[model samples]
Target chain A: MKPTSLLLPLLLACCPTEACEGLVIERAWIREAPPGARVMAGYAELRNDGASTLVVDAVESSGYFDHVMIHETLLEEGRARMVPRDTLEIPPGATLSLAPGGLHLMLMQPVSDLALGAEVPLTLRCGEAVTETRFPVSAAAP
Target chain B: MASTDRSALILLVLVAVLAFALGIHFARRTAPEAGAPVEGMLWPDPPRLESFTLDGADGKPLTEATLRGKWSLLFFGFTHCPDVCPTTLATLRETVKLLEETPDFAQQGQVVLVSVDPARDTPEALAGYVGHFDRNFLAATAPPDRLAALTGQLGILHTRVPLGSGEEYSVDHTASILLIGPGLERLAIFSAPHAAPELAAKIGQIIQFLQDSP
Candidate 1:
């Protein structure tokens, strides 16, 4: 019945979660794969503005692809190998780049055709916070 | 008079010695050094690839003979690979374009992409994947056991990592591109982080060195 309590509930309802407010995705793109290609890779930069570290646990793009997983390319002994990553942690006030030959998203079993210049919706999940973003399908980088 | 003659003789001997030394130095300088090695990590004796068979994009049998008569740039990767694989192929495409620009180098070499994931990369799929990069690009794949015979000889490494649940999995493979000589011999291994122009120049230098050598 208190005015402050009512205000608090209203604020909480208005802003259900602020966890992803500090997470920004820049230059997001999914490499346009060849026809009949089953897999593609997505690249982007994730910037965290909050005071605490943010962890990206999973990526999902339904209907367009079967699933999306985080993967990193490791160069060792003059060889490059891709390793699946369970979680990617972005330090507070820092930007984590997911570029070619580094950290990227392995998109698998595309359900439909993906053309260049088309935008694909992607969802990033970390803990209880979920962020929605769209990535443009671009030509594979040289 | 005899002492004067002796001094003249000594001067003649000194002149002869100096002339001989100068001749030797000029000969050594003008003559090409034996085994003037190429710039890359050229194997003193290039290793011949073991006999193996795989399906080419055109459905023809890819064997040692397929690689004969021309230089080949071979890369072992999966079509699913996004970052390293495509970037490398694109770089190679540019490299090939550069190579083609050189006189007599055009059509003297080919770029091949060997699929490490045969389960998913059928010949048709590979054709589509490789053709996307360059219409002339060739793609091939073989069963795991057959692939081992070739990869083992080349010391190429690849491993499969499961992507959790379902039958989906990803392959981690060596990113180095193997240079195969015209004789089907393994010439050099170009490591990753490859630059198109630099790699093309290195390849040209090596090829020129080989052609110029006896």
Candidate 2:
């Protein structure tokens, strides 16, 4: 059976696999950092397409980074601080946009240099479900 | 040449002339009235900064006097900062590019990144970090006490946060960009989130306002 056009538009942005059932990821890209920079940031927009809420508990980039964590850059009392998150909940039909000064993925200890236009595979761990996406390296949001 | 080409050329000239006139008129109109806020929080009586020294990327000592003779945009962050530091620096670079496009605006504002993490961000490291964003950008840092003397006057604050038991730590510092006048006085404070075009426009307006002042 063919999927309707209404559903096709939403699923087009996600990885074309059965595992990406509940969430659709779009505009996923990593900011290109200066040479020898230990840490870089990745931004994306996540949309929960399922009826139930999706909880993203962990993120991993195989063979690309030593560690990956969800972090938010907060402006408090005129100061900038980075806070780590244990989990992120996306309600049904809700969209989460990860931007520069706000929610972002802390890509730490890149195994090698991430040149512009290079694509790195990233996986998100949601309880009983997992989805994968490729984040392209760019100087700005793609 | 064809008659259509001639007509097109004439139209271009008329449009150019009108644009030039309108540009002048709008520039004058945007200049704020006496003692009015230019962009962000414009200080009615901007305070003159005290003398303090920090290590510059050029191996020279950067003092309050070094910021004289031009407008300076100072940002306080660390090299280890993964997100906001680079984001802000890139925006500052764009701001300078935007200002350069204005006619008769010969002197573009200088951007200085003051590293609050002195323990990790040395002068050499500062050079590499800032030079990546912009080669013309100035990077400076000093020991905790010396740095405190300068940041204290500017109302900037910074504190170190430990990450587990490792030596890794992050410094939470002020995110606001400080605008300094040619006379070394605090001009205005531009709080985030910043847009490059608006920042450039506001700085140009402030410069014009100051110049037109008695």
Candidate 3:
């Protein structure tokens, strides 16, 4: 979705975080990681259905991995460096992309083997409201 | 007096010539850079790592013996790296051809690649990948731990990062080429922005120097 206009807020009021009762999490997913590595990245399109702006700074996953952090990758002087992003902002109706080779969340220290075709439970906590989603670990596209 | 002055002059000339030859030999060992000699920057006393045994793509054991008595160009990467890995391999292939044009490059050594991603990079996959660049270049990989150990010893980095589908991700790694000498000891390292002609000339020069050395 290009993420523009909305009769969306009315529909999302159904599921809102306890702390902040206005914003709603639309969708989230695990992009896809190189096999054999314990770490994985996640992205979400969090929509603020409320009147005020919402800032999301923390995320967590409990299926197998726990250490989740927001980060960005930058390529400078022919070198790639990863840095943390303070908070993710949702100004009412906008969507953010935590895509490949760019801004994303880090899922570290896998507790067990998270195989393909499996779902990883994720929680995005901004303010008080925590939205939950099941992110699927996709196989490399054929 | 005449004999002494004449001998002194001859000795000075011989010393100057010898120094010049040594200079040329070392100079050729350096890769030519952009519009300049790559020897412009030479890593001093490049480390020679202890050798280890690993299996080639054929599932046959490959060790230091395979690297003997030849000027070998060693690279570490995986088959899945379609972008950076392939580009570097192609460049190295060109480097091989450039040296071959020198008429005796093969008399020096061979070019080979060792897969860092051991799990997916089977001997068969490696053979296919390396063959895409050049058939003679050997490809090898063993266990994941062995792959990690070799890369660690050689200073390569491959870390998996998270992607959003919850468990999907990618690996961030260092892409550099390693030069292995006749004794299977690491001779030098080549970093990013590898230039073919320069590398070819430098490798050719190193081979020549090794050939002439005792």
Best by TM-score: 2
Per-residue lDDT over B161-180 for candidate 3, one digit per residue giving the tens place of the 0 to 100 score? 55455754445566567788
Q: Give the TM-score of candidate 3.
A: 0.49
Task: Indicate whether candidate 1 or candidate 2 has the larger DockQ.
Answer: 1
lDDT of 1 by residue, B132-209 (tens): 889999889999998887888898888887767777777877899888888888888888878899888888888888
**C-alpha lDDT values of all predictions:** 0.85, 0.86, 0.67
Off by over 4 Å in 1: A1-19, A140-142, B1-40
- Cα lDDT tens digits, model 2, B131-185, are 9888999999999899988999999988888754577677877899988887888
Could you tell me the TM-score of candidate 1?
0.80
List clash counts for every candidate, in order.
0, 0, 29
Give the lowest summed-lDDT range of ten residues in model 3 chain A: A31-40
- RMSD list, candidates in order: 8.6, 14.2, 14.6
Q: All candidates' TM-scores?
A: 0.80, 0.81, 0.49
Q: After superposition, how far is residue B143 of candidate 1 from its true place, in Å?
A: 2.2
Residue A103 local lDDT, model 2: 96
Candidate 1, residues A3-76, lDDT tens digits: the string is 98799678767886544657999989998888877778899999998888999999989779988889898888
- Put down candidate 3 lDDT per residue, A1-142, tens digits, no spaces: 5454454665466765465435565445564433444456665556677777788877877767857878776544433346667788878666566654467677776677566667788777776567667777653211
